[model samples]
Target chain A: MDSSQRQLNRSYLLRGLTDGIPIGLVYLAVSFSIGLSARTIGMTGIQGFFMSLTTIASAGEYAGLQVMASNGTMLEMIILTVVTDIRYVLMGCAFSQRFAPNVSLLNRIGTGALITDEIFALQISKSGYIKPFYSYGAALVAVPLWAIGTYLGIIVGNIIPEFLVSALSVSLYGMFIGIIVPPARDNKAIAICIGASFILSWAAEKFLSMLSTGTRIVILIVVIASAISLLFPVADEPAKEAAQNE
Target chain B: MNRITLYIIVMAATTLLVRVIPVLLIRKEIKNRFIKSFLFYVPYVTLAVMTFPTIIECTKSPIAGAAALVGGILAALKKINMFIVAIICCVIVLVLEFVL
Candidate 1:
């Protein structure tokens, strides 16, 4: 390879290492508790690890576990997974745009496999073409971390106190709070959307239990509230400026 | 199908369906200004709805809520990292639960 190409390759590897650390830590913390929760509900360690590897989503995985624990049908689990992960469709689409200019079909598909919300956030913030290898590198580190964390959580869960496990369950919520509150604090429209979805879903769950359609209503609330909020004219100031410059 | 096998199939299919359909449908960059801006805020909204209330109620004591709220606000301002904020909240809850 040429000097510039070699330099690019080196930087990509470094980027992967740096990004992978934080992502892996988050996965360990979050998935560890998820493992405990699954075990608490009677899943074996092998089951939880396989679930994490196949799903790679906290919300969807949790929902699936709830369905399994409740002995809900396979059809219910399938529907829940699809509904909860609808946002990923948009995320993948956006990531693909960033790839379309320079990446080959094989590279795009390969790198796209690793495109989670966190990775998409960091990648989208960067300038210029995305190197597929960097994504592969990040995936190499992150996938193993997720699988290992599940194993560790299951093993550690056997020895940990019940109260401690319960407390750690809150950590997932804590991480989500950390992610959401910062952005919502600055964005009024977004704050409204969040509040609306929560209220609507909460109401549905409480009052619509007799209807035998609680989950679908919750999903509907989220999608409708989010869609309406986006229709409003107020633009995020920083994002507006970024768009203007682009 | 076995439960795990069913899960694997459902998840793989969901991932592929979500990934592929949009890529095929949108032939050009999504230049529609409104849709683009909407997309940007969706995650924030999703996060808030999913996380905010739980932050308030995760502990038995009300004081835990106070600590988490404070830590979350601090983290929001970028005064400290997420680890510090999470630790602050967790410690407060742990200590208070032990004390009370």
Candidate 2:
């Protein structure tokens, strides 16, 4: 490859790494609790590490751990995880639109494998077509930290103080706020959609408390995003041309 | 195979499938304006839906969580660096959980 093309790839990778640092840090903190839960279920630190390594999702893994704790059957585990993580399908659909058309199948598969909530948020919020190198860079930092954090959580087992854990847990939420707020501030339609999301989410939590959190989220996304899209369709843009390199 | 190992494999395979299939299948750009618009707004709505009342219940004390939520929103509105905004929210939670 030419030096100029290589340089561009490096820059996107660097941008992704920089953007991914906060996500990596938050994953470290959040996965610590998952590790602790693994320990409570009598799983070893190594097992927790592998679990986090392979399953980078927070909610799905937590639910899986609960299933293991209860000795639920494999069939039961599959159904529960599919239900819990079905949101990724929608997220993947949305994310697929951001790929430059000529990106290779391998790169697309690799990118899809790393689609956690925070990484998806970071990538989707970017202005135009995204390079696979960016997601690669972010996953480099995020994936390992997540695995190591789970390992540490199992091995360390509650050494961290309670107040500190409480504080750290909210960092993920704080990052979510940072992502949505700026865009909402810039666009009126987006602002109204987010406002409606907040109310609907809260009502679902209060009134539909029996439903799993995942189900509630899926229902809200379909309802709010569809309604908002109908009311305020984004102006169509010409199809983005494939960038020079794969 | 050990039971935990089986569980991990099953969990990982299913989760990865959910994320991978869409990207593999939807190669061409979507033409439908409504579908494109819905995809466009998915990130904002999804993130907001995940953050609300949920954020308020993430901490040891609901009050501390709520205070941090307000602090986080204000900090984010100012367009502060996301990492710094998270740190600010963490501090708010730390202080409130201590005092209350």
Candidate 3:
């Protein structure tokens, strides 16, 4: 009986690892460009490594790097970090429903730190109820793989030719689009929101010279999400309940 | 700590707090439906916002980047694996860069 329980835990854990490996590989490249960009803006490989450990956010780090490179104040950096990371608040709330019923507070904090866009997407798409072990299995693979990529990005970015780095940098955006498309295809609200954000982000950046990228996104997400939720409050409630009870 | 080190610490702390505080405070499962669906779509939207415009800026040329974006959308629409989608888009960027 004990062995059977162990086997059950082991199988879920393995399932999680399988779920995480692809995400880890993408992190390896995406954050490599992050490490490259961080190095370009006067940070060391070690700093990039530690920063990736903490943030694991490609865009937030870019925003932070912008503040640093521009000689922006600490106040600016702090605000930028908060503004860019605002989505995590949403992701965290969604993740709350996923933890094993008896999950500890420490485990919550640990898993929270590891929840990036990739990890959240992978875990939420997971069928059936999830255990703490499953999240740990995914985190165990993803977080370190991201850190390694950052370290290599900082260390090896200098030695690599400039042209190839630009090419690799483009891969991160492809990965971002990749993550969202499958889910968006099935959900119209999501698809519309994706379309709105994409068009608005592009327009705001190219035409609205006065608005910064962070502010533009803050406005776009708030406006689009609020607008959609107001229009369609009943869209996913039943599904949410089903997921929670599952 | 010096200013740069302090800078690093602050950025890290703010991002970590954004992630951890919500999870810590909302220990019970939230029952609000609007909030749930709102959170559900945030990842897709935020990620989308990050991708466009910036994607073009990531590549050497706008045309190459646009090509890569279309390829990425295709790979995704096809329901390919995440890593393969990324790889296909990367290859598109490389080939387009070479061609253009």
Candidate 4:
């Protein structure tokens, strides 16, 4: 590529990294709890941090920690991780189309490593063609932040008293509510979907105690989502309306 | 490899594969109706599943955890910033933990 082209790609990477900062910070907070919990379950700091560094899948990691802590089998944990993270397959497909046709294979893999829920939403929401460099920039900023955050959680959690730490962990649940509530408030369909998941999850856990946690959650999500979508499929976002207005 | 080692390796590899396959293959937003609709609802459902029952268990006391969760939902509903909402949840839990 020409010097100007390379410069432009550099700028894209930088911009993506800038956008990634908030996401990384939030991830650090959530993963902090994961680190602490992993420690509670007997994993060393390095082991927990390495897991965070590689996967960056919050729910899957947390689920894995819980399973491991409970003397669950390796097969159980791995199956749970894959089940909880199956959404990444969909996210990956959506993002694959976003990259420019000519972006190299290695760049694709590097950028793809960072395609979490928030990153995918942010990248897809952008107006222009996506440069692979932009994703690389974002990943570089977010990934290390997540790894360090997990490590710090382990270190700090070891020092803090459990009650205070438990108090801090409340914020994790708060974060999830913060994410789901706003969107649910505006959209009736999303509200009902959340409600259904809540009821089913509680019921499933209570009645289907025989089923594994991972299996219960997977069934809850897929059954509720599929049933809701079949009964009432929400219309797609209005991409065309905005284009006309513009 | 031991079970823990094997578990970590499998988790990392499969999760990586899940994130890689679509980016390497699909060129656009998926057009399949079943997959599209299913994907659309996955986030909300997953979050809800994570939140309920578990949220009740996050704090030192059920009262504190419930209070913080209600506080968070109300705060977010009022269009409060998430960072602030998180802080509010922590503060509510801390204070309630002291009282309860």
Candidate 5:
């Protein structure tokens, strides 16, 4: 309510927006692929746009597209989307610790809705309690680019060259590598977990070929993370601060 | 309502619930060590699981995808910013696709 409080919130918002620029750019490339897929499944541009707007999740949206392409029922759609996005629950739990205790119910709901993998990674990487406004700021930039990119991809419909599309397809993985590798380098335990995940995930894909992608991910996360935690429990401290450093 | 429209709504609601419920419920700091540790390591594991094997299938050539994977890891290990690491991987894929 006070001028100083307003100024502080504005600054957090600006910081989030600034940090979110690269994420927005990457979303443009990734969601373009999503849009292309949507079009292939016979979705209109407006439909693709609304889908991206409502579900700012790459994997979840992709799974939904596949389900629709198969004329899968609502039950199938619900199951697949929930399975694909279950990671967000873990992310949300982690983020819950990061929020300032006084963050309102409305702010919590708003910020929680925007908790994409990239944004969650950025938020937890910061050193202190997080403000809802920061998440809001990032979403303001990144979310629009995502929805618009999907719209454009549906409208543009693969007019982009094949070679360029191939190149763009790997950007999301590159960003994922960027997030995990630095932390892995710093912590031996994290590095080991990542290495194990690489091998185990590959094995899961090859051997569990019948399982859906989302199912594989959840199973792997539960097995690997739980096993590693048992072997090397993080030292006693507030989980919030530990997550901040992680 | 149209079928695709209904699907979109279902998908959006499912995704939203996964994200929103935890923050709304877990207001206090978790004190359990294993649970805390699991949460701590969740991001690294989740990101790694999502990236690998899948990344190898994303590009035109599996070889290009593998090359990009190696290049991305090396670039990221050098403490490169995310945007640069992504661009480098894309370039690696582009050139590899051209040649191979």
Candidate 6:
């Protein structure tokens, strides 16, 4: 290959590696249990790893594993997965808007394949319009971390001590708290957003047990809370700017 | 089809469906203020809604929940590293699970 081509490849690899590191660590912590859970539910190692790779969702994967373990019908799996992952529909909608107009259809679809919560967070943190290649760069890093971690987890799942597994599993929740608590501290409005969404989610699970559609429930709750926030955004922004100036 | 393959298809289809529609339909560069603002906050709401329930569901009993609450408080205060707090909570819960 030409030097220019080699340089391009090297850049892609470096970007993937950098992007993959934190995300890979997270995948290691979360997908380990997912792999372990898949095995406990009678999935072979190959199945478990591929499931993690293809699904790329934590809650959706866990829920999917539960349904499969119970010998849920194909229809049930489809319904439950679609329901559990419907939040992604909204996530995808939001993330896609970040894409510049020039991003191609093929690139959008390909990159959209990798738009999980963590990836979305990381990608959005970078400035300027979101490019399809950047998503690919991130995915090139993240996808394998997820796939490989699951593969290893499945292979050695039975050997790992339960305590260690529990600890690793807790990291998933930790990652969430890490994401939520920081911004939540500075912005009362964001905190309110989190609280309202939490209550709605809890109520949906508890009182609306008849509506066992997890994704739909999340979608509805998010839509409601987001709509409310739109109407009544905390009037502190200009006030804060004024206070800061003073 | 096997269950695994079925799952792959469903996931692939669902993902593509969610992503491709707007890209296809909204050919004009979407500059609508309302749509833009709505998109910005949707992710936070989605993330919080998804995360809150899982923390509760992970803990089997009140003690674990209590420990998690402490861990969560510590995390919120940023008193300790998030990873360390997470491990501490998990260890406390594991011990509680063992003891009670």
User: Largest DockQ belongs to which candidate?
Assistant: 2
**Model 4 lDDT at residue A93:** 52
Write out fnat for all predictions, comma-separated: 0.28, 0.85, 0.73, 0.67, 0.89, 0.34
Summarize candidate 1's per-residue lDDT along A1-246 as a digit string, tens digits.
479877886788788767667567767767887787787776667777777776677667777778777878778877877676666676665565555464556766665666665565445434455566677667667767787777677767756554454445445445545555555555566556666766665565567656433244446444754576456644444344333322
lDDT of each: 0.61, 0.86, 0.75, 0.73, 0.87, 0.63
Clashing pairs in 3: none
- Predicted structure with the largest lDDT when compared to the true one: 5
Give the least accurate 10-residue stretch of model 3 chain B, judged by summed lDDT: B35-44
Displacement of residue A244 (Cα, Å) in model 1 is 9.9
DockQ of 3: 0.62
Ranking by DockQ: 2, 5, 3, 4, 1, 6
Model 6 DockQ class: acceptable
Query: Which parts of model 4 are misplaced by more than 4 Å?
Result: A1-45, A58-80, A90-112, A116-142, A149-157, A236-246, B1-7, B32-34
lDDT of each residue in A94-132, candidate 4, tens digit only: 456456777777778876777776666555435444567
Better of 2 and 6 by lDDT: 2
Per-residue lDDT of B1-100 in model 2, one digit per residue for the tens? Answer: 8899999999999999988999999888899999998887887888999999888788999999999889998998887866787889899999999999
Candidate 6: tens digits of C-alpha lDDT, residues A1-246: 479756764675576567666567768767876787876866777777777777778777787777777877767776777677676666666656666666667767766666777766655444445545556666777777787777777888756665555545555565555555556666666667777877777777777767655654565556765676577453433223212321
Superposed by TM-score, candidate 3 places the C-alpha of residue A60 at a distance from the truth, in angstroms, of 3.0
lDDT, candidate 3, at A72: 93
Let me know the DockQ for model 2: 0.78
Candidate 3 segments exceeding 4 Å error: A1-22, A30-44, A66-76, A97-101, A127-135, A153-157, A235-246, B1-3
TM-score of chain B of 5: 0.92
> Candidate 5, clashing residue pairs?
none
* Model 6 error, position B92 (Å): 8.4
Q: How many backbone clashes does candidate 4 have?
A: 1
Q: Model 1 segments beyond 4 Å from truth?
A: A1-13, A36-44, A66-76, A94-100, A115-138, A152-157, A161-246, B1-3, B19-27, B60-62, B79-100
